[model samples]
Target: TVIRDEVGLSLDKADKAVLGTAAKVVLTKDATTIVGDGSTQEAVNKRVAQIRNLIE
Candidate 1:
């Protein structure tokens, strides 16, 4: 998704530890909808945006 890619790009210059920490934050925030069976693609995209905003 666009938001995910943007976050990844923004974190490109981050050290591995920082990136990994960011990844954990992103995963934790998005985990529920991402792992839910009824979650739509749009829901996933919104979650990505939420995670991106948190990191940025």
Candidate 2:
């Protein structure tokens, strides 16, 4: 269940099961920031490589 909103304050009411965990979260009218716990470093590196390949 992907929740889409300009600001994610609505997540306050969302069920815990559908919500994700992050080291920190900050939301504002213009942006949302999620700081991860770095457990997905390999996946992030792979995606970054894929993006670089695409841009090259």
Candidate 3:
């Protein structure tokens, strides 16, 4: 489960179940990116389509 808020900061450390694993992560001052391991490709595709629909 991904914690989508600052409340996640309260945790000293999160377990793998709480924080999903990924191949790579890139963090910038304004953004954080996670490269998944393809296990959730279908979910990703669905989310991308949702975003595209919202954008259009």
Candidate 4:
């Protein structure tokens, strides 16, 4: 909870579990399909997507 006029950060365990499941589903897909042409932009975007899909 937030104190009066103050900001606080907290991690929700439930959200993490759900995101872990979603990442496993997304990252298991073929990288080639996600990044066609293998151009510079495609490669960069693919790498970023892979990083985001990581659970931790």
Backbone clash numbers for all candidates listed: 0, 0, 0, 0
- Candidate 1 per-residue lDDT, tens place, 1-56, comes to 23245456554555655433222222455463224434579976896887788869
Query: Quick one: RMSD of model 4?
Result: 11.7
TM-scores across all candidates? Answer: 0.35, 0.40, 0.48, 0.28
Q: Which candidate is the best by TM-score?
A: 3
lDDT of 3 at 8: 49
Off by over 4 Å in 3: 4-14, 45-56
> Each prediction's Cα lDDT score?
0.52, 0.68, 0.67, 0.42
Best by lDDT: 2
- Model 2, range 6-42, lDDT digits (tens) per residue? 4464666678766757789999999776788464889
Q: Is candidate 1 or candidate 2 better by TM-score?
A: 2
Once fitted onto the true fold, the runs of candidate 1 whose alpha carbons sit more than 4 angstroms away are 1-36
Clashing pairs in 2: none
Clashing pairs in 3: none
Model 2 CA deviation exceeding 4 Å by range: 4-14, 37-56
- Sort the predicted structures by lDDT, highest score first: 2, 3, 1, 4
How many clashes does the backbone of model 3 have? 0
What TM-score does candidate 2 get on C-alpha atoms? 0.40
The better candidate by lDDT, 2 or 4, is 2
What is the TM-score of candidate 1?
A: 0.35
Question: lDDT per residue, candidate 4, 1-56, as tens digits?
Answer: 11222234335323543323221222445552232422478766776786676525
lDDT of 3 by residue, 1-56 (tens): 33434544334466666666788999999977778656667888886787677559
